[model samples]
Target: MLKNNKSDYMNWIILIGVFVLLLEVLFFNRGVIFSLFISAGMIYLGRKKSAKKKGKILFWGGIVFLCASVFNMMTFKFFLLAILLHFFIKYTSSKKNPNRVSPVLVEPEITKQEETVVVSKPLLDNTIFGQQKTPTGVYEWDDVNIQAGIGDTVIDLSYTVFPKGETVIFIRNIIGNIHILVPYDIEVSVHHSVIAGTTTMLDFHQPKIFNKAFHLKTPGYDHAEQKVKIFTSLVVGNLEVGRI
Candidate 1:
């Protein structure tokens, strides 16, 4: 249920992938069909992740499909798609397109007075309690303190409230995809230097930090900069760097 643990998640993917491959080689000899089923199953299971996450399922699925496809060019579509999409993600991810964008998260600063006064606005919490399924979740952030307990709790921080001036986000145990959204026209500075995950800056450079992870981005040179400073550190998790 808790989807933030990176090691566990990757292990699941790998385990399932290898299992699927073995099944393909032994039982279901439909070429990419095995990979496709495994990937699709994972995606369906992780339907709650995100748009990019869904893509990742397919993406990694494609990676597994490669081995099986080698023997059968009959399913050229799967092979071509896997190679093309994998490279496409790699190319676009590495090349750094200034025009591409990602979701925006508004981390609000809670003054003492504001904290005392409970606003009636909706918050992005991880769970919809009492419901059968949490198709939509909200966030509520008093602060992302480095408490050992809350480390790998994949927060739906889409609606988190962050302090002004400077802040960095951290992940402890789980491998999660931190989805951050910046407002259009807000000159917010961004940085993501964390271990275990890649950083991508949708419209800017990677965050300056000590051994940062993956995928971090902010407004590129084409856009105006903000006065407020924002720093994010995902000690563990995928930093899906982008601005859209």
Candidate 2:
């Protein structure tokens, strides 16, 4: 049954791909295929003859042509339409459900008093495009857990003192590197995963890793009282953990 389902899924994908190609040829730009091939040839030739002035022109021209071809394709039109349709549906849904009931509203008999509380800012704030580093001077120790869109994360354990038990540092990045500096006294355990990158944890070095997970640890990590446990994942990047 699973094999049949898989075959059906593949068939559907092939059919959809063929249909899209047919649409591109018949209804949309017919020369897009040729344009892409030409662009690729131009780019290859340009790289081969990179020292000459004509190579520079070919490189830039190929880039421009590729962009033009992509933008004029049926797929791009579908992408734009999908974006517009998504926004339109979202706006309509928001307008219709303006007074959506919360979980608290469902429990009518339970009355609770509202209390004011102070919220402290986290040490490693989430960012899209910037480095997240530990403070240089003396600062309170906090468990680092942040999701970054595209940036390097640097955590230095030398500045702040760690509490007893396991100190966790969890980081998730779409496209960035993770570098952690740990003191020699502190035992460390790392669980790092990457889609396409490398890992350099202490003396261990994985030059080219793809879609793999690594579990590394100091010999004393299991029994150390003030040890740090790092969990990091990246879509396309590197991981490096070393002694400070």
Candidate 3:
């Protein structure tokens, strides 16, 4: 209840700020919108928990400044500084989602294991968190249709699995790090291309091959095929490969 009251008060403050911005735009039309909107946007963006959102907010801000410039209202010099400020702020935004610093009152998941074939939203959202259980030891972990964030997530998993025939890990855009462990005797093929994480080869009983950031550690050239791919240049965070 105390937290709820705090949230309500903050909202009221934001509302007042928005009202002030509107009044500034009305009364001071020269460069008022630029200053007013930027101020309002900065405060709003400051409270946002997503890095992706900060970009959008900044992007819209650029559009506003660009529009102002095109109309011969604000100088391009002012526009550039305003845009650069927003771009720079995005770099520091999300090491984690702010609202999720602690477990909130989100409703619990009640799905059965059979129904829990995991599907992920943006991964950067409220997805890869809240629970982790011991893997079922039947060697069924490989080829498991696991869905990980394709975007920047506050927290993620590092896993290792070996499949009898084939294996796959579906990654969208994991922000931080990804470490995979495989059986030392299996021949594995990994297919992934992403700029967010650095993939490194590790020494094991198996032979390891790397192409640029693509790495595959194999006992020998079994050519027994299995693969995973992650899209590159994702609007997310970083990734690093390591052993579990």
Estimate the TM-score for candidate 2. 0.58
lDDT of 3 by residue, 1-244 (tens): 9689757856765565566546545764556546544543443343233358775566456446645544543333444554576466555554443445666796759855654577643322223532223243432233333334322322212334443454444544333233444444444455555432244434422212122344454455455554332223221233343334
* Candidate 2, residue 81: lDDT: 66
Highest-lDDT candidate: 2
lDDT of 3 at 17: 51
- Candidate 3's displacement at residue 106, Å, is 52
Better of 1 and 2 by TM-score: 2
Give the true-structure RMSD of model 1. Answer: 20.8
lDDT of 1 by residue, 161-229 (tens): 445434444333232345555444434455545644445555444443334443323445225432323
lDDT of 2 by residue, 8-67 (tens): 856765566568878888777788878986875575466546679998698668778878
- Badly placed stretches (over 4 Å) of model 2 are 1-116
Clashes of each: 42, 0, 9
TM-score of each: 0.29, 0.58, 0.32
The model with the greater TM-score, 1 or 3, is 3
Q: Mind sharing the TM-score for model 1?
A: 0.29
Clashes of 2: 0
